[model samples]
Target: GAGLGDHIDRKEGQEHTFQNADPARRQLNQSFAVTDHCSKPLHTAISDRIAEGYTGTTAIRKDAVRALSLVFTGTHEDMKAIEADPEKLQGWLKANYQFVTQEFGKENVVRLALHLDEKTPHLHAVVVPLVEGKLTAKKLLGNRKDMSERQDRYAKAMEPFGLSRGVRGSKAVHNSEGWYLGQQQQAQKAVLSDLPKLTALDRINPARYEEKVQERFKFVSREKTDTAIELKRRTDQVRHAQASQHKAEQEAARHREATQSIAAQLLQAGKAGITLDSSYALLKAPAAIREAANTLFQEEVRKLADTHLKQGAEAYYRGIYQLEDSSKATREDYERHQKHDSEETRNHIAGEITRIFNQEIQQRWGVELSPEASLYKELRKKAADLVRELAKTILQELRKALGLEEPRQQRKSRGLGR
Candidate 1:
């Protein structure tokens, strides 16, 4: 039973009174009403309306039933599943809405609020008890038998949603919500009562618990320092790898461009009417062109390998040196912050490590590797093959123009193979 004083300061939309509330989760709270529940509390908003429409002239009893308050919710896991599915949440809300409306009439079912500002999803509903134009909570829900029947009916109504009735005929006595909470607190105290209770003398004794605190803090600080060092080490390794990859890409690009240039030179020589054995040849045009193409391509590859490999090695070692410098800075930072011996420092270090690993390292490694290097190598191979084929075709055509035949030894070998 609530005292008259209870209603003095109570108001609607004040959900902070509920246990297990988290202010951070207030954004997830939801409220709905068939009437004006936001501007007034549930009792006055719902019960007063039902009384106004009552057919009987008899005054409403002081102890008469007002709003029938109900809490509808499930365990954390079940609530999470329901929250994930809007259809499931809608179905659950609709089921409860139907039950309340059918039992108390649509006009009497006033307020339905869903609270997500707690550990689990739940709803608080107010149903004004108006039966056959009379306000009587006892007739509707006074006895245990009636209550159990109501539970059974609600359970059956919600069967489509996979809900079942709690254990029937259980011997647990119903108590007020405040009483239940008080009992829970007592039980918690009893569990913790086994620990040694400290006296006033023990509170001021520095020798008792101070050493344990300092030891724990020292252990946590050391762990954080080690973690910071490890993270710096891995970051350096990744930078070194990236530097080497950059060098490889530059080498591939340079070689590809040089190959295209050489092909262009060959095309220009052909356009100039320089025959294989023409005067343009250092000795003879045929041998001279062959030497130029092979030697130039070989020299390009040799130069590319030397330049890129040397630079990549140097960059890798320089990254290692930079890593050492960064590690020293991190160590100094840790020492500066560790003197405070606060939990915040440990948490910050942990969060930083997680951020670096998840964001930086993950993005770097998960990125799609560039195909330019492989494509360049492939193009180089194709270019070499094209040059060989073209050279072979030109040699055969020239021999024909010169009225030459296959050498006698080569012709005999072909005949033998056939």
Candidate 2:
């Protein structure tokens, strides 16, 4: 996409002096006259205009006329398809030109110039936004209605060409949504309402209260440990599946090697003039026994070749069977692993709830004397410890499942306890 100012140097009677404006902001103007008589020569006219310096104009003007040149760049994939048949591409452009003109405005839109001299083929569409004395950027952008409505219309317009709406970034959508102040107010209110309630006695007898809190903390830790264990189990199942597939592939390769070895042995025996036993030989063999034996030997050689050919087909079928079996086994193992992991995770989560109850609820109430408070605090601590241990175990299992090398253990001291 390119844009620049046009008519930088005003004609003798014009009021505006476009050349006096900043050169950085101006568009240099040039025009070309073409005859409609020859359809085949349209490309030649466009090439001449590009060479004469109309597309990349840089002249500045104080009150310059607004102009834009749009060039559709075909990707490598599109170029490949178009190169297969150039006429198909030409027809496509001719059909889509009307839509282009409608978007830029019928009067504002100029003739398209096709340039075929460059390494990449592209169409140059020159547009002058100003029709009469008025110029509209919104009109040129095809923003005739509200943005949402325009998007819907654009989707409909491009549907026939197998083109869908372009994807806008997630940030753009977020910014658009955040424009409304009411959403901000609702978000603030929701956050405040979710905060936990505090107790009055939390300020007094804090030491006694802390004892009960610690006990509950242990219980919550234990539950999280269980969850980590479950995740590890799932990872192990995936590894098992992969191992099974590898074994099947190895077996297949061995079978192929065995088949080829047998064929080679048979071919060697045939060349050595080895005779088959009488039971194996056909009748009318003794009269031309030497020639008949040779023919029989050649038939055996052909049989060996056929067996070698069958090995390839057999390997393919075996591979396919292994793939299907491995896929099914892997899926089953994963499902089982997930089930165990979820159970462990649930236990860990339960432990967390106990910790939260002790720390945030029971401890605040200063209920250390109560048997329930002490039990809860102990449970929370246990749960937290268990969760930490399970996490380490899960990490080890994940490495093993992913075929990563296990870490070496450090040597322990041989001395007895002091």
Candidate 3:
């Protein structure tokens, strides 16, 4: 049968012992009591010597019998933690056992005992050849190549638990390059042996292979190349557009800041009780002071408008009660006052003019003084004539700035004249 063999002991009733086994020759050793099927009473002192000797010896005798031993050792602390919660430990062991069984055939594997006599926790697995045979020490215990691969596998398996390979002096196992090469050779042998056979035509089909190669080349050169170029172009376009928009936004923001600063200065001037005429003169002052004066002037105009409206409302209400004969005259007088007598009304109208001036400042770096201002009263009297002259000057400047086109009729007339 290929399954586990029936229990058999070579020593019989005599206690099985290996007190003289060399310690250096043993790859792995730890004390464990036999419990699953076999029972043996071995003295602690003799058992310890056997384990130590097995680890230290190297010589192998001809005709020596081969056997497998599996030892399960448990620490008092781990046993307690596991006993308190057996499901956790049991789950871990079950998964580990499955993995081991897959790696090493289950039939050749054996669990010798589960010992709870130690302070540290561990499991011992002893694997033997399926049939009774002389097991070389190199085979029973792993060689350098086998040990290295075993170590790599162990590290990979324990990675999920956050265990890593340690230094030479550390307890963690290390893998060597030689072990890796051996594993690669073993894998290659297995693969070569298991691969199915194929006919020459089935493996190489020349016409079909040529078609596939051409198709791949066309795909890379045409579709992939075009897509890459388009991607680069789109990326550059997007970056350029973003930069342009950012520049425009920054310029707009700066314009807004400048306008606000001017308004503030005007407000400060109004608060200081400076006459609008005097403030107008300050417009030609240094940039910082000019902005302050403009803000104050604008504020003064708004305040003047509010005052006029309030006063007009009061006068209108009072005039309605006057005698009928005097009422008409009083109403006419009130109307004139509302139209021009109120300083507040003049200031309110001036504020609107100042807003227009600010717009002009943005467009042409120039501000127009309101005709209603005390300093420009004479100009306000001939407003229509003054406006005509100013408009002509503005048109001339605009023509110069824009390089205005000549009228079609004028061009034709000039041609006829010529």
lDDT (0 to 1) per candidate: 0.54, 0.43, 0.43
Error of 2 at 248 (Å): 33
TM per candidate comes to 0.39, 0.25, 0.24
lDDT of 3 by residue, 46-131 (tens): 23323333432445454443334443322245445653555755654554465555544454343432223322334544443322
Index of the highest-TM-score prediction: 1
lDDT of 2 by residue, 63-97 (tens): 54345556543433454455456686655465446
Q: RMSD (Cα, Å) of candidate 2?
A: 37.6
Q: TM-score rank, highest first?
A: 1, 2, 3
The candidate, 1 or 3, that scores higher on lDDT is 1
Top model number, lDDT: 1
Question: Taking the tens digit of each residue's C-alpha lDDT, what string does model 1 give over 335-413?
Answer: 3333532445333333332333224222432322122545234433443343334334433444454455757776787
Candidate 3 Cα lDDT to native: 0.43
